[model samples]
Target: MTSNAVSIKQIMTTEVLTVHPGDTMEQVHLVFRSSDIHHLPVVDEEGRVVGIISKSDYYSISNAFPLFRPDLRAAANDRLFKSLLVEDVMTRQVATLTPEDSISIAAGYFKENLFHAIPIVDKGGMLVGILTTFDLLNYFFNQEVFLPT
Candidate 1:
């Protein structure tokens, strides 16, 4: 490996918000609506990563339900969101990496799969952090030291 080869640990966000399988979509919606984050990793009580929920996943499923239509009454959307569980909409097949994994590896996955975010887990399969495409860009540009526009 190169002397300066960056690893996922160097750029991953350690503090992350998560949801559980039984949590309602309404809770997920609230998190998405209230924050600027694009992804939420789903974890069990033991902190093991089980699935993932992306903003796109939420919106895509929203459209799948008739009541979530913007034209429909707000109250209906509220009720529907409350009724659906995170397990119902979250992607069961999740890809993850460890903090020690190289950024090159993560970049390859992001490029090939077009994933916006990838959760980072420990050896025990516990959620630890998240690596996002934006984080990669930030690290890349910082390394380049772009001048003011």
Candidate 2:
């Protein structure tokens, strides 16, 4: 069964914020800090999806700075942010979907994987949107309809 028995385009987020390979961790950090999004699709100059950065990925990488140093932690984190690039840490082997893909297929992807988000791309591999588990929840909760058994 799928959501609304339709394409995930109905629930995917089109106005997605992104980061680039060359971007500093601090730059991406600001975006993560400011937004409620848990995943950021990393795109190239041509807007082609190259990789993805999850909030957990960011935190896990940065957490290497300290175990619990309240004082040195800030400076260490700041240093890491300045030195590391998005490409240096992002997951390069990202799974992507098209806007027209079936919601059931995407739900299956979510069910089978540990990741929570998938970047929506065009036939040419240009990113157009993103779909997350949370988006599916919103669809389930907000829609007046559901796929019948």
**What is the C-alpha lDDT profile of model 2 across 32-138, one tens digit per residue?**
98989999999999999999999998899778866758778888888989999999999999999999998888988999996899999999999999999998877
| Residue 84 in model 1: lDDT | 93
Measured over all alpha carbons after superposition, the RMSD of each candidate to the real structure, in angstroms, is 2.6, 3.0
The runs of at least 3 residues in candidate 2 whose Cα sits more than 4 Å from the true structure, single-residue gaps closed, are 1-4, 144-149
Each model's C-alpha lDDT? 0.89, 0.89
Candidate 2 has an lDDT of: 0.89
RMSD of 2: 3.0
Lowest lDDT 10-mer window, candidate 1? 65-74
